[model samples]
Target chain A: MNIHAISAIYRFEMNRMWRTMGQSIVSPVISTSLYFIVFGAAIGQQMGAIDGVSYGAFLVPGLVMLSLLTQSVSNAAFGIYFPKFTGTIYEILSAPVSAFEIVLGYVGAAATKSLILGIIIMLTATLFVDLKIAHPFWMLFFLVLTAMTFSLLGFIIGIWADGFDQLQIVPLLIITPLTFLGGSFYSIKMLPEFWQTVTLANPVLYLVSGFRWSFYEISDVSPQISIAMILVFLGICTGIVYWIFKTGYRIKS
Target chain B: MTDNADILIDIKNITKKYDNGFTALDDVNLQIKKGEIIALLGPNGAGKTTLISTVCGIITPTSGTISVGGLDTIKDYRDTRKMIGLVPQELTTDAFETVFDTVSFTRGLFGKPRNPAVIEKILKDLSLWDKKDNKLRELSGGMKRRVLIAKALSHEPDILFLDEPTAGVDVELRKDMWNVMRKLSQTGVTIILTTHYIEEAEEMADRIGVISKGRILLVEQTSELMRKLGHKEMLIEISEPLSALPASLSDFDLTLSDDRKLITYSYNASHEHPGITRLLKALIDADIRTTDISTKQSSLEDIFVNLVRDAA
Candidate 1:
């Protein structure tokens, strides 16, 4: 198991978050706060309610999902990439730790950071809107599952990226656009049938829809389908990670 | 000086072929004894690092087997890795970590329990105790190299591999590193280091192994290698200038100086009878008066250059 190695890598990574606390933790909180102020206060007054819930309240889960997806990926990607960039990965590779332990250490710490940020964003959202949770347990479950899934995606990205620009490509280009179009600011039902079908194809929609269902019992997709989609995504990411370790892909060679 | 039973690492016919059809190692074989210092000498791209990396399990060989202390590197990877500590060629450390924290963390990475006293002693041995709390980014290049050594030793492994430990370090620090290595050797830690510096191998290693073009050229005891391959030169300074060598000296492979005043004779020191007495008698019989006589023994540098040049 090499628990000490896991904890060592975990503690080392977690300590880096404290060193860059402003960028890692605070920037997302402040950015999400601004989203709340602009979307919940300025725009919600004119937009009215969504599915019998206030527009401000409806935006909470979506906004949190937006930040959660991007932050988790970026945090995990940069976590692994920086080690490769600096050549410190050799130390880890030569250690007594196995590949699974290394992944658990890096992915676990990154998810923990993103989860903390997700909770903070949720708390900050309460300041701008009156939020409700119809399924608190499911809400927590979805929060953790999404963080872990996206963190694993970020880990894969970290290993695949050969340069700094590539590290930002997925989070900025793909994830941000998907989250924006994933029912973050509005319901997918408002779109035409064609666009609704297109929006449903975006993976982020499943996450936001499932999380919104937990909060208000109003969702673009069924809760069970969303959970199933996320679980599949989680499984795929885990399989890729396993393959990476088995082949000694970027970390070893 | 150890016996066969003391062999700590056994690498047999290990070969590494990269994905791009390049063979980095070809049928390499070596046996390292415990508690002895061995230096692997080769030019850049000679696969010195690759061989060490394979034994450390960082890079898997395409074929063959490697066992450390009788534990197969692949089947018992954790146990094998636990027995080794490597100070890689690259200068990499966590920029934000205090020296103490990083060293302590590396020990834990090897699954070692907390032992502050041992860490303190290693820091003190490397003269890094004063900077224990300083961030690694704040240290100089030499101090960072020492920190790498401290990290490698933190786990208290049975074998340590140092890849070019003194490449960029200054003379004083190199000497300090040598002292630390000497101290470690006294404690029965087997040391294998790869280096381009010939003098480092000469000064520190008990055995020297030369590799060129992915093949092991030779591995021999330091003193024995010197005696076997080393050539000695006898320079005879004539009291009077001679335009040509005397007929009696025609049997020797001798050369005259450009100024025509010195006769130099080269002979293998390992020869049963070096024929020094015969050369002196020949000089006397020829009535070549000499003002000075001196001999020079070849150094490890000369032997290394010759070996590499021949291989090329």
Candidate 2:
């Protein structure tokens, strides 16, 4: 199993995170705090409640998911990509560790970092709004699952990207915009009937809806469908990662 | 061929062809004995690094097989890789990592348990213990090269492959590295190195293998190769100048200097009888007075150039 090898890589990556704590931990925390101040304190007072939940509390799950998704992808992608750029990947490649262990180490570390950030953001939210959790177990479940799934996606992007610009393409252009439109600031039900139908097609909507349902028990879609969608996405990312290792994609040749 | 037990690495008919149809290695075959130091001498783009990379399992061979310690390199790579420690040609390192941490990390990567004692010994051997706490970027190029060596030796592998380990280092560091390699060899670690420095091969390798154009021309004991392919020249200074060579010395392969006071005779050193005595007698019979005589043998550099030139 090469457990030692996995832990070595894991510790190395975690150490890098600690070394860059300002960018890794503090930046996301500050950004989430600003979201609470601007959106929850400033804007929520001017808006009415939806589905019997306060507007400020309704934004909590969506905002946390927003940061979780972006952080997970960027953390994992940059972790693998920097090694390739610096030519240090040869050490890992020539070592006795297998592909699975390499992925486990890299993705596991990335998910852990995102999970920590997500929890911190949740704690920061308590300072701005009155938060509630109808299903605390499911809320934690959704957080861990979402972090892992997006981290795997980030790992794939890291292997696929050839340049630093490409590393930011997915997180900045795709994920951030999708999160804003995926019911982070408002409920999709508040939209007109036609727009509500279009919002359902956005994959981020499923993640935010499923995560929010665990908090307020009010969702745009059924809770079962959200779980199914997340599991399916996780499976797809796993399959792609397996194929990449098998084919020796950008990481190998 | 020796017994299988004595053969540590057996490479047979190995070829590596890149995707662009360039053949980096062509039907290469070699057998390295345990604890012997062999040098692969070649110029740039001669597949020296590719050969080392393939044996280290960094690059997959397009065809053929390699077995280390009787275990197939492809099928049993984990076991085989555990036995090899490679010091690569490039100076790739994490600038942010401290010397001690990077070396220890590599040991763990090879599945070795944490042994600060072993890491400390290697660092001290390479003269890197003083810089152990410094970030890699803070060290000089020579010191970074030493750190690379320390990392390679951290796992205490049975075989070590040094690919141009002294490429751009100063002469002092080069000599220091040679001494370290000698000590490792004394410890029964089989060492294989590829180098552009002919003197390095001549000074360190027990056997020298001349490779050119994706093929191995020959591999022979250093002393034996010198004797077999090396030539010798004898210079004879005459007591007086002459207009041309005397007909009596026409039977010998000789060339006279422009001043006509000196003559040179070239002969194969491998011959049992080089005709030196006969040539002296013939010179006496021809009534030519000799002032002084001296002989010079060819160096490994000369033989290497000729071999590579002929192969080309």
Candidate 3:
């Protein structure tokens, strides 16, 4: 609960993040731009506009979500996992640092990285296609909420992981695949009824739908439902994360 | 020691058992008087690390209790942790952090206000000031070990636990670490360490406790333990080769050494045994002759091994 400890850790972690500005900040920008080139410019010509938005414009929210989720996961994952890998966890664990301080420092840095990248991708999306913002406030809202949620998710993943291999398993294999299937690039309504129903099961669908609704003023799912789903998801993830910290699960023993 | 009422730690019958039912520690009881260094020594998997972890409140015990400074380790972790600094057996510091920032961050973790002078003194004592701006990965392993020490001491805890502080350390750095421990102890900081190397324990501990097979076999003053139970060895240089132990020399507990050119006898120094004269005469009667004899006194290792084996 001490703000000083948490701020100290947060500051140290921020310095560490800026040290890898190329990987943390620039790489996501480049990746989003490439999506515009290959998927937006090239593929949009054939696919035309799906639902009510251009193919290029349609992919923006998904790309933003993709970056936010992965960056949040990776930033938090590498942030925590490296100490354990390089044997520096002993320093952090043995100090007077509370579990809350450790979590705040790491998760706060991750949330910061996600927010910055989300904005960068948003600005980058505008250059490739005529991007619009129907609700800039909601867009910022979902962006910050989703970023914090996934940052907490990444915190859980980091503690659960013991080695580098463990750190990559959930993000690379699970999160990436879910994003692809969650209607990031294509609308579920375009699919057969059965596939559309299955796509509803993807938790990522709400994140992308909520974000897209903010920009286009229209989405396949209701904006209210999308917002609610994200909040619920955040609840589940926050519960898990704080519970892990309070009990001193993997971090302590 | 401050009146026993002010005992800094009270560890009562703590036991640790893993998932597979193997016990790492069992029925261990210890009280650490304020301002004392207690060394826990044992062979590998002898529960030394387990004991320290339990007291530090990092790992929960399967049974019993540990109270540090006055707070229970599990129930009152926040207050309890404030008074303890544990340098783990692992070198787990941030690889990309500068030495100054790492130690300073450690102080901040204890809710201490930013103090550059305190951080400077800690780094200076650890010889880390010169490398204050170097990333940890850029430093030598010895320097990294010093960082771990500095980070531990940065919080200025009343109690510090060093687990194998010199396990892979260089001799020079080992001596320096010893000096640091002495300085901290002089300031009335309680130090407890678990070490695989007995010599380090012999050099530093006021009292030594040997842990083996999930139990503390003996806890005694380092010197007193040796005086009471340590054994000695004497090597006899024989003029003639001996193929086997003599029939009448069974009382000597002897072994052939140097390809049978010498006979070595081990005996408890505290107990009455067959005199060296009787041993030499028995060797002569068996047509065994020795040119000279050399002797070696017992060390802490000998006493440690004997106690562990006896309990096992």
DockQ of each: 0.73, 0.77, 0.42
Clashing pairs in 3: A87-B91, A87-B92, A88-B92, A88-B93
The native-contact fractions of the candidates, in order shown, are 0.72, 0.75, 0.64
- lDDT of model 1 at position B100: 97
Worst 10 residues of 2 chain B by lDDT: B222-231
Name model 2 segments beyond 4 Å from true: B233-278, B283-298
Ranking by DockQ: 2, 1, 3
Question: In model 1 chain B, which range of ten residues has the least summed lDDT?
Answer: B223-232
Error of 2 at B154 (Å): 1.4
Stretches off by above 4 angstroms in model 3 are: A45-52, A95-98, A242-252, B226-299
Please provide, for model 3 over A1-253, each residue's C-alpha lDDT reduced to its tens digit, 9 standing for 90 to 100.
Answer: 7676788778887898789889889988998999999999987889967767889999999999999998898888888877766766655665456676778888998999899899889898889989889999999999999998899889889888978888888889988988988888888888899988888888998888889999887676899999999999889988987798677777765
Error of 3 at B178 (Å): 1.5
- The per-prediction CA RMSD against the true structure, in angstroms, equals 4.0, 4.0, 6.5
DockQ of 3: 0.42
How many Å off is the CA of B298 in candidate 3?
5.0
